[model samples]
Target: RAVLAAAGGVAAGGLTIGTAALLGGTGKGREPGGSPPEGEAAAAASEEAGTRAIADPVRRAGHLLRRAGFGGTPGDIAEFASLTPVEAADRLVDFEDMDNSGLEERIARANFNLTRLRGGDGRPGMASDMRAWWLTRMAYTARPLEERMTLIWHGLLTSELGKLGIPRTKFMLIQNELFRRMALPRYDDLLKAISRDPAMMVYLDTIQSSAAHPNENYARELMELFSMGVGNYTEQDVREAARAFTGWRLTAPPRVQLPEGASEAERRAAQDAAAEAYEPEFIIQPRLQDRGMKTFLGKTGPFGGDDIIDIIMSHDAPSRFIPVRLFREFVHANPGPETVAWLAEVWNGSGHDIREVVRAILKSAEFNSEAAYRAKIKSPVEFVVGAVRGLELETDFRATLRFWGPMGQTLFQPPNVAGWPGGPAWLASATLFARLNFLDAFLFPRGRPLRVEALLAREDAAGMVDEALRRLVDGVMSEGARAALVAHAESIRDPVERAATVAYLVLASPEYQLA
Candidate 1:
């Protein structure tokens, strides 16, 4: 285990393990209001609140895991706290949580499935039904981060919807393999995998690329979007790199559907559209790849696709890009130079060991400090799921849909693949309204998977609310937050329901949005 030096933060390991601690009940000694947690801000707030910050380790670990991976149920969070940040992260990066079925099983069940067909459209074979179901099933799967990584990679390497001909099936294949399998691997491997994916080939028009007619889009993105942050690669590099990828179109044949009932005219129109969508494939006249030596960022390549990949991955710029994004995720959006410099050094030195980048951030002073806890404004995806996690909502298929659908988020369906704009993009008055509605909908999760009310009744309302707050917000709510919730509970008759209601209020609060 390669380790980075921790300067006054986490030890060599991220976990601080011991016998698991039991969460306190709402015995009279349990404070009703949530004061700030201990550390810098807590020390300051203590002056005004007249109470010390309570160190709720479980809540702290829960906050860390949610931002690092998917939100955890209360029990899951407790177990998570027992593991150091590295151990917990190992489970996440290894995709250990995603053992629903073997890859072969995943491939077999989805092999011949068709997603959509308008009954009377008379298209030869309909597939919209199969595609929608695929997306929906992925949404409900327990491994949200793996899926989330696939979604991110898809945005970065977007394919056109219409041109994929059998877009639905091909899309599922790329998602299941490239992104899911390589989600936690080194960035170099992921970039090459994207270059090989049939869906990406079609989407980026690379499949049509030939020695004579090179496709530059894939090459341009290889530097501009994927590896080096934009502006590091030149027009000269883009032109030469495109030459490297000639003759790399999709190896798989297009799935031609013959939906019944359509006239010849309708089929012709569809075929025309498909042809246009796939024109690059059939027409990439062969061109000679640049055999003369070329250079990209100081590395010369008498290059083929492999040489181009070698040059691209060896660049220092990507070292900065990968960790900067990772820091924004594990830490917060604006990681100061000190943090990025430290993380970038680790990434570059470790040959882009992704786990190293994650470990450094998790153990850094920032991750555990009071300011870092609950600092990110949860995106719609996190907010919805985190609320369900806090309430221990038993979620099923439709229940999962309600999480992102109501908030105008559709994961892989983000408008135009630049990815649903993160941070401010998630906020709008309308979206905020949807967020509130979504939280209330939780206690009554659509599929009714878990009887949330029954669970809450087992514990009094205020106490359960406190537990929910500890898990969701990392126990950072203000004293005013608790009082406001308690006041809201006064109107409800049953203590359990009132407690659940209060949990809803805290989960819905704006504070939960931050890291």
Candidate 2:
């Protein structure tokens, strides 16, 4: 419950619990917090003014939760709806003081150890196991934004469990934790850390890099994808930058090769010993490093990996590039020049502070506009995580992995270094059906009773449909969607079955797929 003082233009204690009153659909109203909500006439008078600026608390809260984190629960929405935009942004972005012992305890209780591999192409179901572990955190963590930012980094910085291999899976977890700890870190610091990060080193071939033959893989991606975007840096710059990062390698985890003719028990013992002895860490071999002056991005004088990152930060390209990508991730797929310019200003002014840039985007009028609401399709991860949180369901993360792959997203296994194509790419014919089938299974597993008794306060069909829509879709279902849901609910005479059916349909609806 530790809170920072409100930052930026929003005033303190300026919002009230008007969401309940608004969602009740009674036109009769007085503005909350003793300030009148901006009327449409006033809104019409200015480009920035709108009903969403200080009114439409529910939609505003939904937008925040959907983008800032995964979609939230009704309780999450209601609580967030009570805060002004800046206050809500503050609660999410400034989470350094928050106690996350509950999430830690849950993870401990699960006892998911990554080191235990089941053999063959690394570990069987290890990627799924990892996905489940993180999904649990996303569903139950106190700091949703932290988990959301971790996912964002995972997608953007891009690593694959398949590429990292099972023996090195622990390094992927290490990278994940790094993103969480520095979720709102300065851009320069994060780049510097990731450049030397053990998992990243292995994933991008930095481990194989040497002065004799500098591997340009990491260097190319560092400039083209990670920092300056494609085409901003030349092939020569990539070559020089690769030299700067030469000799970056990780400690070799011991591989136990059982002696021929050894008994099964003896082989097991050796494998166990190697597993226990393994310790992965980053190491720079001076002998393998290039010491001679190397020109990179027009700078010369024995630049190292850290120096290359520092030089990238010194340029405006990183400042412009990162904020724009972040804007698309959080706001909409397409960003106009004006939007980019505004966010870039925040980036520069805040010294490339991620939190400041994110806060600015969340608080901007663009984020709350109709153009951004449900504008992007839900990536499979978001859809699944949102469903679990929306229903307040307890789950075995392992079970979820089966559905995730067919539904077009498998955690820790992005298709390439560029990561998940996201947005409209998630809605292919086969994948869309997979999404529907997964929801059907999730809502009514094995045709058994639904697990949402705690979520339903009413038993009748109409009441149940309303509750489902309210809880799952931020109560923003269209009239046709509502009518369709109610019809489906009424078809089932049994109240629980009816409620579950309604929930399933809403989840399967096109509206739910958007966020």
Candidate 3:
């Protein structure tokens, strides 16, 4: 429905992306005071000689947007292009002040039924609806970094709606909201909160723990995945940590009162309404808790869950592991030791402040280096969201939300606790087929004309391709790819069809698959 409306809007001349917007006009790469900002200057000084900062405003802006958020549109790129690299990075990092009411309003208008749960007879789609809601936010939100960081946290401090049980699927949404609220929080605080998070407790089996038979799932993942990588802690540490976390449980939500004359269907409806309003809070049962002194990580005491988290945060491994994870996510797949060391220093000095660590990463010499530019493959979510955002198209994408499963990255349904393999693992032949087909549906939905006549208004076939390239991918195409796209566009006579085909070809090309 939204796609049809957008097409109508395009026919009515509502769609526009002028040449000035494409080139960024006065917006291309401004250095405040005609020099690198203070942090960027220091980062520049740290680089090897001849390792220049990204000079092209467009490339630098694209890199920043791709890493810090999903991909950016031409207008988004133009806005960032005008600022110094440090200024741009800071703008995204310090995002709390940004007005997000527009995105909020869109979400309100969607009118998603958050309380809908799968029935006992094997009904489904509520989880998919939740996934669609988030995808919509990613595609259209004014503050992409916040959503980006929320995604990073979701991948790391992971949970699964499937294991959360059919009745409690909406808890995943609650956990998602928590990630957004504390997206850039201090590392220790985030860990502590996750230890007490209801969804996480359920997913990791923290709620099933007892003093006599402590559940080690949460403790093992806490060290191996969340804080430090494996081998940093001994088996004893896992056992002791599990003991400390015993008695962490989920509280029962209040049930709805059924009227005497209520029918069975009405009773079920009332129960679901109550369930929607009820979010289980994390609680501790003192009777089941381990109060005995236990030695964990060489520290002997009556340590509780908070104490274990504190010990993990105080260790040096989190400083290294977390920065390495951040580096992998943003900079490159394999970061040099020096880069990791620099980021670890920032992590330690900033007292695990996520905003400061992310700021240093965005301003780092390595992040701006050529090796990091388009170096990683886009995850399934990134690929879909980037196209929508870059094309500036409108659509009620909830209908297509199921594409994530076959494309290989289903939200709230990661294959395992380790999360998606990402990188090259996302480009398997079947997945590539899925990507191409999905682009076809997106560019020309059900034979409806593309809302891209504005893209066709450029000079000719080559010009239209160039304009589409600039709008979709910051004109970073190779000569061969550009020639191929132009040739493809020239073959199609109808300008609207030519423009849509060119846009589709460019997006389907392998060049656009890398971030």
- TM-score of every model versus the real structure: 0.73, 0.87, 0.86
lDDT of 2 by residue, 293-361 (tens): 988778888899999998888887987799999989987766778778898889999999998998888
Clashing pairs in 3: none
Candidate 3 residue 218 C-alpha distance from true site, Å: 0.1
Residues 425-486 of candidate 1: C-alpha lDDT, one tens digit per residue? 56555676677666656554452323455336545545665665666665655465555555
Off by over 4 Å in 2: 1-54, 119-125, 255-260, 263-269, 272-276
Pairs of colliding residues, candidate 2: none
Per-residue accuracy of model 3 over 1-515 as CA lDDT, tens digit each: 12222222112432221222122211123221122224565445434322556778887898889888988888889999999988998999998889888888887887655567743444335776688789888888878889999999999999988788766787888889999999899999999998898889989999889998999999999999999999899999999999999998988877789879999999878877777768687789999999999998888999999999998899989988998898889877677787778888999999999989888989887787655666677898888888777877776577676577888988988888998888767877678668776777777789765867548678599999888788766686545456666766677888888878877776765556777
State the weakest 10-residue window (summed lDDT) of model 1.
Answer: 1-10
Q: Measured by TM-score, how close is model 1 to the native structure? A: 0.73
How far out, in Å, is residue 170 in model 1? 3.3
Instruction: Give Cα distance to truth, residue 136, candidate 1, Å.
Output: 8.2
RMSD to the true structure for each prediction, in A, is 10.4, 9.5, 8.9
List the candidate 1 regions with Cα displacement exceeding 4 Å.
1-56, 94-166, 252-295, 298-301, 399-408, 440-450, 453-455, 494-500
Give the distance in Å from residue 351's predicted Cα in candidate 1 to where it truly belongs. Answer: 1.7
